[model samples]
Target: MSALILKDFYVMWKQTKVLLIIILVFSCLPGAFYPTFAVIYAAILPYSAMAYDERSKWDQLAGMLPYADRDIVLGKYLFGYLSIAVAAGLSLVIQTALTLFWERASDNLSPLSTIPLAVCVGVCVLALTLPLMFRFGVEKGRLVMFLIIFLVCGSTGVLTGISSDSLDGGYYLSLALPAAALAAVVLTAVSIPMSLRMYRRRRA
Candidate 1:
């Protein structure tokens, strides 16, 4: 599993430098929406890796190796989880630094508050998309994934529309964050098993 994750990271580093650059640029932007985009977009890196794997028929080769289908499926999920964490952490730190150093940076971007929601949304995006990729090939799944991305990105507008005062730091921390966390957890719990089953069926 560790090797699988490392392989995807290497593939990402080699193939997706442009996307990574875009994430960095978005993270430096002055609003919650851009930072959220950075995190969620980072989460999609695993999907890109999977697409490459399919192009190379990695799954056929992987079946010859000792690792089980569960390892392959879970590896993608773990890679995505780690990617989201790294992006969310970076987005938060960058936003914090910008808010401190840049006069134009909006304090209302609220890195402390916004990052949790972004992470949750990223997690949920993986939960929604991974099973599709597993059940169908990456090529077939790409369209649905794009639609999901469009919807999720659109929803960030609603988040941005909410006034900082209405979000009420304490209320956000105590209520919204927990609710989002719970939803992510539930969706991921369900998603993992579905992905595992689909991958196994595909293998069979």
Candidate 2:
């Protein structure tokens, strides 16, 4: 599983050097949404990795290798989880720097608070998308996944904005953070089994 994840990481680094640079630039920007976007982008990296795998017919190759089917599927999810963690960590650092050093900073952006929500969003997205990618090919799965993400993110953003305006910031964070984390955990637990089944079907 570790080796599989490392392979995906290597592929991602090779292909997304320029994209990472762009994400870094955006991470340093002023808006809270930028950090969230970075986390979301990181979550999707595994899907891109799967696209490369599909193009090269890596599943056929992987089946001939000694790795188990479960490991093969789980590695992709673990890669996504790791990517979200790294992105969220980076975003927190940037947010902290902005909070402490940026003189014109007006928003009450709590660095710690942003991480849970960003992670939640990223994990939820991966949980929803990965099984689809496993069952269908990456190219076909991505269109539907993208649409789902667009609607969810759009609605969530609007609701969050309304909540922030209506409630105390700390009060909202206190409620929202734990709820988001719990949801992510639940969704991930459910997603892995589904993905494992899908991969087995596809490989067969």
Candidate 3:
């Protein structure tokens, strides 16, 4: 399992370092966009890993290895989940640091309430995307993933507009964050079995 995770990381490090850096730069922007760091990366990194797998003809290459299909699928899901967690964790640290800086400078601080929302957004994006990629190869699934993301963002926008007038940010976030965490956990568990089945079918 560790070897599988490490393999994916090596693939990511080799292929995605530049893209990661490019995305990280945007994460520094002010306002509610901070969570985009984790969300965007979580949404992308697994697909990037998949592209590598396909390019390497992973089926032929992996057949001789001792690893099981479950391990391969689980490793990819773990990588995606952990990537988002790291991104969300980084955003938390950045938001905390920025809050301190604003206090010291006596500046009007942007609300940190969006941090949780960002975490949720990132997870939801993954919940929608990972299964599609697991069911279809990454290349074929990309369009559907984009459509899901668009609908999600659009739905979120509509919800925000409808509730913005009445609900306090704190109240909304407290509810949303837990729901997001639950959703992430559920989706992650389900994706693992589904991916395993898909991989098994391919092998057959």
lDDT against the true structure, each candidate: 0.81, 0.76, 0.64
Report how far off residue 113 is in candidate 2 (Å).
2.3
| Candidate 3 per-residue lDDT over residues 1-204, each given as its tens digit | 888778888988888897566546545555443345434445567778888888888857888999887778877767876776676666666656766786642242322455455555655666666666766776677786676557446644533443343346556666766876788678767766776777777667
TM per model? 0.91, 0.89, 0.80
Name the better of 1 and 3 by lDDT. Answer: 1
RMSD of each: 2.0, 2.3, 3.3
Q: Model 2 scores what on Cα lDDT?
A: 0.76
lDDT of 1 at 95: 86
- In angstroms, the error of model 2 at 152 is 7.0
TM-score winner:
1
lDDT of 2 by residue, 1-204 (tens): 899999998988898687677657756766555666676667777877898998888988997899999899889999989988888788788877887897765465643455567678778888887888889978777686675568446634633463355256567767877887798899889999999998888767
Candidate 3 residue runs with Cα over 4 Å from true position: 103-111, 148-167
Q: Compose the digit string of candidate 1's lDDT tens values, residues 1-204.
A: 999999999998898889888888988787767887788778788888998999989999998999988899999999999998988888888888887888777546565567778788788888988898898977887787876678567646544544245546556455666777898999999999999998988878
Q: Give the TM-score of candidate 3.
A: 0.80
